[model samples]
Target: MNLDTGSSDIWVPSVNCETPPLCKSINKYNATASSTHKQAAGSPTFNLGYAVGGLTGLRATEVVSLGGLTINDQIIGEALSEPTDSYNYPFDGTFGFGWSIISATDQNSTPLDNLYEQKQISKRLFCIKFTDQTQATQDAIPPGGELSIGGCDVEADYWRPLSVDGFWQIKMTKLEVGPATDGGNKLTLCENGCEALFDTGMGPIGGPPDEIELITKQIGAHFDKQSNYYIITPCDIASLPNVDFQFGEVTVTLTPKDYMLTVSPQICYTGFSKMNTKYQKADYLLGDPFLRKLTVIYDKDNKRLGFANLK
Candidate 1:
């Protein structure tokens, strides 16, 4: 299963008549085979909506193991119906890390919250170190990708307070292009500021349609109507200006190398996309393209997010 910081329920496919063939292709959780399995009363259905698709399932409780640690009576959803696009991923399901406020199950606490309550970990914190796409493209197994629960290794350079306690969201103060030192040439994109969600499940950085289109145009990219993305010639990548995201007092910069998604030797795509309306709470979603540049720390206890350069 993939670790999803945007949601709040642990889900896996179930072996049932409603289960799709794609779910079977991955792995299925057999509730009947587990001695610790406890069906929720009323067999209430669980419906989870995502940025693109959704999942429908039944709720259940069972023991879940993570390395040597074991969590008993962990609340989980047994997916009976999933979107076809969900099957394209390597993960069978998602292990949500968001707060219970965003949970589909209407539970009082999440698995991570339960672990903290059980005194399994000293700190209610998790760290994510994403692999650089450029490095990953060259090597089969990039060395730096990590998901550390309870604590992190590096000291944070800046800590951004969460605007909402639900989805690891932060208040973005500004968005601009070019270096901060280059005051005359800097182009302000989102001067009014907006809320941004830190989503590990998303691959590209996303914003409002108007803002994304403006950024693409400024970066010498053309809209590919068929692909529904902004494509640029590989030659323009080197000359493109850096984009900067300001979170309160801290500003993180992403150069063309960080925000350009290489499609082929001659073609590349901008990392920005139109914000999916399904995620209505935030105007922006910062994904791997931005995350790969920093060591992100999700501090549940403090209700804040910390960022530092990768070690």
Candidate 2:
């Protein structure tokens, strides 16, 4: 299952869905196979639409176990209909680590909430440590990371209070381009500060179209209409400057190695992209590129988030 902190709902395809070729490859949940499965007939239909994909399902309850933490009577979406083309990934389902206020079920049905309420976890917090593969070579292992539930890693050096109740949103005081020592140009786009979401579900760094266009222009990144990404020549990677995201007094920096996704030896794509306006409420989305540079801790107890350099 994919762990998404930006969303607040759990969904897995059901065996009853006979969407042929699509369902054939996906692992379906069998109610009869699980002794703890319970039907939620009176519950409303489960429907959730994301930036690219969506799912329509029925409500149900089951026992969920994660990293040895067991949660009973957890509400889940038994998917009846889903777009195979959009969800054709390695994961079979999605587990939300967000607060209940954003839950599609209109109830406090998130696994994180249940675990805390049931006393299964001592703390209402979790931490994520993404492997720093920014400077990886050809022989380097593919992207991988660790998610710590119930507790946070003591390695976090700084903590920032969340600005909103739903997503793990924070205020970005400034965005600077070039080297910090050289006094990089402080972009005026966020002069008054901007709302940014620390989204784990997103892969690249996303921002408003105007802001992204400016950043790409500053870095000499050209937008590729075909691939819908800002392309940068491999040779230019070495000459690229650092991009820094300032959250209050904390400044998270990303070098060219961190912001450029190397597709191959000859081609590379900028990790910064234009945010999808359909689902974008925040001015910026600090995705994997930002998270990989700094370990993040989601503190639900105090409604704040923490960050630190990896140990």
Candidate 3:
């Protein structure tokens, strides 16, 4: 069992098989509660078939304990050949962490897919807020506080403070490109709570139409022949001013030179890009790049996120 601050899932490269596997954790029950359309209260979660390349079904709890959980217990994931065939995860297969019974949306708000607004940690999609051991992760989640199954305390803030602003999950208010000085459109900010979903595994920035269009214009980037993604010149502009994240009156300047987000080295020019299509109510997906800039605290209790900049 290994520990990855990235997506959650118990990947026992030894035997889980490549065809499919079972719920190594509690996400099963949680997902079952999502849309039990059936009157018998069928399990909301399911025995999702994942392609873990050449691995085995490693129990989630087993992995957590094996890794000597000190903080932010590790969640097992599936390993695949394509690297993006998450069937469920483009970042590979992840343990179900977002379920109606235990998500913020299930708590009262509506849930997307199976991620409900009920609890903080979803037993089904049990993913952790990964940070680069890259000097950004603050006091890790006390491994002793490892969560499993339906275990949770609404009043409990298992969330510890990170060195950075705990990856601020701010709302995308609006975006602008280029340097009002250089006259390039290069920005993607959020509204009140950045309704965008954060996925560390997927490509850097992807979202609905209007947003993607604005970013491409500012960064001097273009769409790939594939028409699904964009490409731009890679530069040492990590710390450039064109890339800005606005949270309230607080406008964050993501200097690639100082902080690297998106986790994709190919995106030479650092700027924002919107996902041309809306998957649901969610607009954007905060990729690894933006997350690496700060320590993201998934404080499920209060139903709000926290972040702190280590750089």
Candidate 4:
């Protein structure tokens, strides 16, 4: 399952589902096969739409186990219909770490909530450390990093209060280009404070079209019509300026190497993309590029997020 912090519902294809050819190839949930599974009263319809695809299912409760921590009576969706085009990936389903308020499953307590309430975890929080793909490949280390439950690392550099309850949304003060010493080239963005979502489900950094165009222009990024993405061919990685994201007093910086995904020796793709039309809930979606540089802590108990520079 994909650990998605962007959405607030757990959904897996059900054995009864026949449509979406891919669903039949992937793992499906069978309520009868699980001893802890319980169908919800009335079996309310569960419908969750995403940027790419959507799913329609029925609400159910089951014992969810994550890294040995068992969450009993966790609300889940038994998908009866799925999008084959969107679910072609290897993963069977998505395990949402988002808050319950955004959940489509009748606003029932989320799996994380159940973990805390059932004493499976001492604290209402979780931490994620994403490994840089570039570095991991060179160092021969694991690709994906660790997802620690219950508590956060003591070495966090900053903590910001969540702007809303739905997504892991926070306030961003400004976004700047260039180094800190030269005062940087501050973009006319987030001047009035912008809401940003730290989304694990997203791949690239997402923002408004105009703002992203401005950012790409500043970085000398050329849009590739074929790939529908921006690329910096013959990328002079060392010459690129640092991009800074200011959250009040705390400023997180992403170096050129951190934001560029190298496809080949001569080509590198900038990790900047426009937000999909379906999900315009935030000013920016800080995805894997931003995440690879810091350890993110989702503290639901205090309704805040913590960021620490990765070592």
Candidate 2 structure quality by residue, lDDT tens digits, 247-297: 777888888888888788777899988866336467888888888877799
**TM-score, prediction 4:** 0.88
Residue 162, candidate 2: how far off, in angstroms?
1.1
CA RMSD per model (angstroms): 3.2, 3.3, 10.7, 3.2
Better of 3 and 4 by TM-score: 4
Highest TM-score: give the candidate number: 1
RMSD of 1: 3.2
Where model 4 places Cα greater than 4 Å from the true spot, the runs are: 16-26, 87-90, 179-188, 276-280
Of the two candidates 2 and 4, the one with more favorable lDDT, higher being better, is 4
Q: Which candidate should be chosen as best, given lDDT against the real structure?
A: 4
Pairs of colliding residues, candidate 2:
none
TM-score of each: 0.89, 0.88, 0.49, 0.88
Write model 3 residue lDDT over 245-299, tens digit each, in one string.
5544544354544332343555643334454323223466666556555544454
Higher-scoring candidate on lDDT, 2 or 3: 2
Tally clashing residue pairs in candidate 1: 0
**173-201: candidate 4 lDDT, tens digit per residue:** 99887632234554556778888899888
| lDDT comparing candidate 2 with the true structure | 0.78
Indicate the worst ten consecutive residues by lDDT in candidate 1.
Answer: 178-187
